[model samples]
Target chain A: MTNANPHRLFRGGAAPAALPARGGIGLKPEHYQYILDTRPAIGFFEVHAENYMVAGGPFHHYLERIRADTPLSIHGVGLSIGGDGPLDEAHLDRLAVLLARYRPESFSEHLAWSSHGGAFFNDLLPAPYNAGTLARVCAHIDRVQERLGRSMLLENPATYVEFEASTMAETDFISEVVGRTGCGLLLDVNNLYVSCINHHRDARAYLRALPLAAVGEIHLAGHAREVDAAGAPMLIDSHDAPVAREVWDLYAYAISLTGPQPTLIERDNDIPEFPVLAAEARQAEIVMARHAKLEAAA
Target chain B: MSAAFARALLQPDAPCPAGLKTWNGSDPAKRFAVYRNNVVVSLVDALADSFPVVQALVGEEFFRALAAEFARANPPRSPVLAWYGDGFADFVENFPPAAGLPYLADVARLEWLRVEAWHAADAKPLPLAEMAARLADEAALPALRLALHPSLRLLRSAHPVVSLWAAHQAEDVSAALGATDFADAEAALVVRDGLDVDILRIEPGAAEFVESLLRGAALGEAAQTAAPFDLPATLGLLLRSGTIIEATPSGRIS
Candidate 1:
């Protein structure tokens, strides 16, 4: 028999895994085998919740094993939280089932919308920062938290264009939603740098305006550079390459305010080997440790 | 804004929505292209991931153009992209560019079935010994019903889809494709053998038998549906592959 006591795995005394205040990486299918074989000492692993919204497959098989050993974060990419339409209850129900199964240490969704009028764009499109949009985003978060029975982190977006109809700044908008919804901020440093640079705003002032004390996690990813039509440099939050030097610097500054938090290296496209991404995750650890030491000395 | 934004995201040539603006005076048209590029690129990428064999059948460049056209016409309605291209087979049949490869649509269907099989629910198969005991009761055979694995799916086609799919596994796809003829029809059975999915080329009339089983037909009625079926051979394959999850007899008060 494969199991002399299969029941031993579910004794129910093992404390549920928590998101460690260290570095992590996005769990990709290509790295599943490598992650299992090497058992790299990654602090945590985050996966796109939409990817595992399946009945059964190798994804669940490996996740069941790896999740047993390490902390996990479920980052949702398709909730359409900023949409003016009502929340997709069926999707929320699925999220409830998944959260019950995994019980991840952290759950997070974006401040962007992906679907509208029965058509899903499959990309995190931006929404304006206004009273109406803010109230709607808060309501969506409330629904998600109520449905899943847990407070979730909300990530700021990396947007290229602003809305002419906007009445509030992006940072003020996020702060209002965080205050009204009582949800934690994900604080994607890459997004901060990307948006600040794209909008020609001061990155430090932008970070200061954010509700830094409410940050639960941080995201550090790479971006692609391009030229806008008016001959200004535009940066797209393309998680294809290594975490940018500027983004890493911004991460250090943000952590200095929020203290060490669970940071993730978001590499979705042009994914390298597991060890390569792990090494990048280690870089985040080094940055946190360096800042932490300075804080202690201060 | 979403109505205009969602509409514009799918239509590349559509003018940027009225309210969009860049931080600088630079044209929002250029910046809006970023969202346009993301929506179109990501959807095409999802279709490409789900249909790699189809992409291989057609060259990469051709596949991208073909996928982009499909993406624009029929975007994914749901967020879970595992079943994204469910209607690709229908689209391909009417696609004027793929007229030469009439069997392409069936191959696409076969591929989509494989995707479904991969994500289907997991279940425990009935032990072979238990199945043998149940098979021995001839009188109860008429009333016995078997529950197939949740992942089990069938695809029937005039083209040798099983051979075509298996040919992709070979080092020389052209050589493998050359060996199979399209005149013969084939039925493919997809089931989760374990954690992995297995696609088998079921024997003649066996698809009808499997279809009956899938439809909850009784043992004797399902057996009669497939003419001249080798019960031992077919049952051996199904039982060994862990496709039959449960078998219960009817008319039993006990």
Candidate 2:
């Protein structure tokens, strides 16, 4: 198959027309008309790859219209990349089809596993960070990159539990995966904050441990606060509300380390009007701009 | 190990899989419970989205409970949540909690059909001019085979499921709630035209005619099989709704 855009190379050699290091919002069906009519000054639009897997429909109709004006990032939630069993060849084929059709500026999947034993749990579940699991994950990533003929980013997962069999920190596991597969990292700062708070780890230290050079994109979203059984604060990566103050702080810190990267504001549940999300994307843009200016001056 | 962990997470009462721990070095049971809650609740929400009328009729609390049970017993085998509830209507049919309401299963079936039609493949309907020309050739009209649109689905239920479904779509369903007669048998035809999935009630015999056509029966054979139904009106409905994709002489077109 021929690359639709000859000038754009997603994986090998030099890259052109990459997603600019600007802010974007996750595309929702509710805001399709608004985004098209108002033509908001955002960086790009991201959508779940699974949502557009249909043969033909309104989803594709709107996506075609929206993609004409703005860049798009395809974030997949159902690849089951970290599952123990073999990767689902059928799902990979579907993803390949979508990626080829859109030739999205960026494509990413989560680090967690969501399927096993032929059953797919809708939620991302935690996996042990051991030699065996690491090898399996790396192999999965290799297969995905080979099949798509493009390098993809893997985002760290927000977890509520840890496994006793884990032999490495989550950051180290991710860094090693990147090292072996040559895949980029799509760091979700909100997930880092939620995982750190839930696991009683230092968020700043965790950020410091990540391989910032491999960071190709960042995600900022909202989380819900709840109490654990021991009466400790637990943060749920529920993208239903606006970005939290603490997550914003972490995002700024991450921007300083990684310079400007393609950032996205994800609000999947209880979605407000388009403006509310636009405002959040604007905040991310402001942060990236400040870092850009500082780098230019230095 | 991943498979075992998945089994534990899906089953709420199952013990935490071996070799799991919390960050504080305590038992991972409580923390794992959170993951468990997320999996079950997310799947349940998926079901509720696909079957809104069933949830509305069953009430939120009861629906959540029912969905949770369904999730635990039959977690999705695929990641695509849109296709996750293929067996839900059957599950409800045998569920003891919902035994008091026999129509609940039919409602679920109708909702599932709507979901299927909404995502079904798109097809361009046969042009009216072409159809008219074909009809003018009376010699081959009876042997002409009609191909239905990919989104067409016919459902037959012993209860007034069509009324129940329509009532739930209304702004205020109080009158519909009172007018529904549970004993009446109903048939529904769901088709996706453009971006909309429309549900229309049809006579039982008309449903049979469409089903026969779907099974590759010729026009004359299908009409004969439908027997007492108004074949002309049924054919008109099919044409008007754009459900017929193609018409070809039986032997000429496979």
Candidate 3:
């Protein structure tokens, strides 16, 4: 492998304190005006960096205006962390420019490879969890950290299938990545529910296996249910609907384990009215508040 | 595992495993098939979103087939699916099925410009008062090299492209809408105002005027480029459209 030699040096700066360990909603176009007027009491906002990765325009203006009032998190979807290929230097440079401009409180990306052999699949795709792939992913993370000059939270992917070549569990893969690269984790609770249900694993058990100490953020989103040929329904992490009851329960369990990390409510499609999403964000706030109160009481 | 499972689950030609991998009475291939379809479909949808008028003119089925073909050839290069169709205009130009709709490729080019403009970097529009005051000093004025907004995009085609695009919108009643001939070439200004992409047709010389500034020409040089046509009206049009966002001082203007 081209990336077998790991240079353990990371020169990024410290994260800003502006990103509160509270709940936020993904800032979609539908809710822009409502967010401006209401200024919902959430922690911070997260946006797809690619959505704002342009030279100039209205999206940039709106984001600049929004960033003035709220701390922002630039969640990237294109880094292709688990690919067998070399790191995309141009994409990272574009990302670095965005990071410098936005001064986002935190940055994150998924741990799945969306591109292979130069064809980028927009969806987060799975990767084998063997030693070779792990080293490759760690090297990529190190390069990303060095390029952006900041540590990023790597989100676990919601995968439907696994390769037979996998030598370690998903949690072990994530933990090993963190252990080797010192990168943080953005544990998407809905993904745990989706992947667990799809792969026939227990969601709670999967959460328990996670390196909770390395968890820096959490994501909660809606998922769709589809029945395959055998009349067995599988959960799809669609992010279009409201967070499922079980996923919320899993989030509560995650808060108990990870101690109330910054959480986000992500709805990319079939987005509802602003108040509805704020109400969802408030659900996370309630969880964080409840957990904080419990800790204070103890 | 069959070759079907290997191609469907893993990348093409990857080694096939010899057993059915199931944990909860579900075939892994059955599940993997959904994701593969979703990945391809979502990327195709992204291209469609970036080129709606092209899709509209071509119709959904044709566009979907075209998109699927394009997807196979130029799958997205970035995770940001929004930027996936940057090269689509060129692809449409070379596409066999779309060869009949010669203007269709230009329309796709215009739509892609709209996306580019809409997502371009945000910069503060120069305050009207400051610009007006700056214009008062001729020495300061000509020396000023205007900064076009990131969303400002200029496109030129040998076809009546603007009316073609406008016909797709609800309000325009222009007769020569979608069926304009390639002989009726047109130039256009695609700029983002606030959050909306505003596309306007420019007369023969007007596009040249703005293209000068966009090409990094200073005010005087840009005006010279627009001189073959009337320069003042073209400059006024650009100003009104909010095309120029800022200006760098050329010490010589002072």
Ranking by TM-score: 1, 2, 3
Report the TM-score of candidate 2, chain A only.
0.94
How many clashes show up per model?
0, 0, 10
Rank ordering of all candidates by DockQ, starting from the highest = 1, 2, 3
What does candidate 2's lDDT look like per residue over A170-191, in tens digits?
A: 9999887877777788999999
Per-residue alpha-carbon lDDT of model 2 for B1-254, expressed as tens digits? 78778889877778988887666665567777778888888889899999999998999999999989999889888776778899999999999989999999999999999999888888988888888888888888789999999999989999998899999988889788789988899999999887888898989999988998898888988887634788888888888888988999876444
Alpha-carbon runs more than 4 Å astray in model 1: A1-18, B251-254
Ranking of all predicted structures according to lDDT, beginning with the best and ending with the worst: 2, 1, 3
CA lDDT of every candidate: 0.86, 0.87, 0.78
Compared with the true structure, what per-residue lDDT tens digits does model 1 show for residues B1-254?
88998888888788988998877788898889988998889988988887778888888898888888999999888888787999988998889999998888898898899899899888899999999999998898888888899899999888898998898888999999899886878989899988788989987678888898777787778888545677779889999899999889974212
Q: Please give the C-alpha DockQ score of model 2.
A: 0.64
Clashing pairs in 1: none
Candidate achieving higher DockQ, 1 or 2: 1
What does candidate 3's lDDT look like per residue over A228-256, in tens digits? 54667677888889999998888988898
Give the interface-residue alpha carbon RMSD of model 1.
0.9
Candidate 1 has a DockQ of 0.70
lDDT tens readout by residue for model 3, B163-197: 78887785653454535554788889998777787
